[model samples]
Target: MYINSSETAIIALLEKIKSLEEPDSAGIFYNAFIVILDAFVQPFSITILVSLVVLLVLLFFSAMVSGSEIGFFSLGPQHLEKLKQSTSGRGKLILKLLERPKRLLATILIANNFVNVAIVILSTFIASQWFNLSSFPVLAFIVQVVVITALILLLGEILPKMYASVYPVRFSKSMAGVLNVLIKMFYPLSSILVRSTSFLDNRVARKSHVLSRSELSD
Candidate 1:
């Protein structure tokens, strides 16, 4: 009787252990699959990923403009100081930015806007195709339009601009450091492109002058 009771107790304990381990095996497998899926589906995980990439590109361009402005301002800081001393000191920074940085910023804005527009158009087109709707009904169209516009405006433009505007100095400084590293990494290719662009601009300017002279003579 003692031997039989001990054998029964052991069997019960073994069965309980097997039951607990069975659930854990499936749980582990499920967790492993989830991790793999998350890794593979990164791009689809969030709607903002694409917008973030665009924003980063815009920020990079902005950093380049800031760098160029810094270069111009530092070129003759003493001269600028003398001018500032002669005039109202308050307008000096504004004037310096207006002379160069503003133009660079405007170019960046134009590029950013163009990219945003392209993204909106492409997204709408793809959505339309995916839904297989011949023409969007009025209500559905309105909703689609609003949703798409809101996404682009909020995610791509307003949010980033607001953040940058509120913390311009900090953001610019950080971006400047990043851009410096990137420029160093790509210096060889960047130098070639810069030189080629400069050469082309000079050639275009000469041609334009010659054409203007010919037009005046005629």
Candidate 2:
């Protein structure tokens, strides 16, 4: 009746270990993997449910941000001309963002990283709750590194970008509203990154030009 937080946690871990010990519809390795994946399959409480939901939403946003990079950048000169002539507010916003391409790219990179980090954090929390992942270092590493990396690569990066590339304007227009908000929110950081990269690029260009001139002299 007087179970403290530690005791509760211990009890939960014990239950998870007990579940792992039970026979399932699969073999040892598969069952172990399933045990680690229990967070997705079993939602025993509202907190886990909410975490799962938020994790999914973050993943979706990650996909959107990743896709937006391809969507906006792949726009051709003709597409940009169309954007300039278009009366739609979203098209106007897209043109505005493209005016400062470095800043816009920085904003998308920052937002994508933020969303992906959140997804990893929320996923870790959910996994920890469902299983004593710490007890299995290798399994934990697999789940955390390999599995999550694959998910982010496939779901957050590749698939969305593929779609975006095929329908660049539509994807960019769809993401215009979200991108506008993110550009403002991340303006400070994005600007700093833009300035730093610009400075580095100029330095590199100068160095390359000097090397070329020296080669000509020789």
* lDDT (tens digit, per residue) of candidate 1 on 152-191: 6665656655565555443444444443444455556555
User: Residues 70-99, candidate 2, lDDT per residue (tens digit)?
Assistant: 999999999999998999999998998888
Q: Enumerate clash totals for all models, in the order shown.
A: 0, 0
The 10-residue segment of model 2 with minimum total lDDT is 34-43
Q: After superposition, how far is residue 20 of candidate 1 from its true place, in Å?
A: 40
The root-mean-square deviation over C-alpha atoms between each candidate and the true structure, in angstroms, is: 17.3, 6.4
Displacement of residue 71 (Cα, Å) in model 1 is 18
Residue ranges of candidate 1 with Cα displaced over 4 Å: 1-99, 174-218
Native-referenced Cα lDDT, model 2: 0.84
lDDT scores of the candidates, listed in order: 0.50, 0.84
What alpha-carbon RMSD in Å does predicted model 2 have with respect to the real structure?
Answer: 6.4
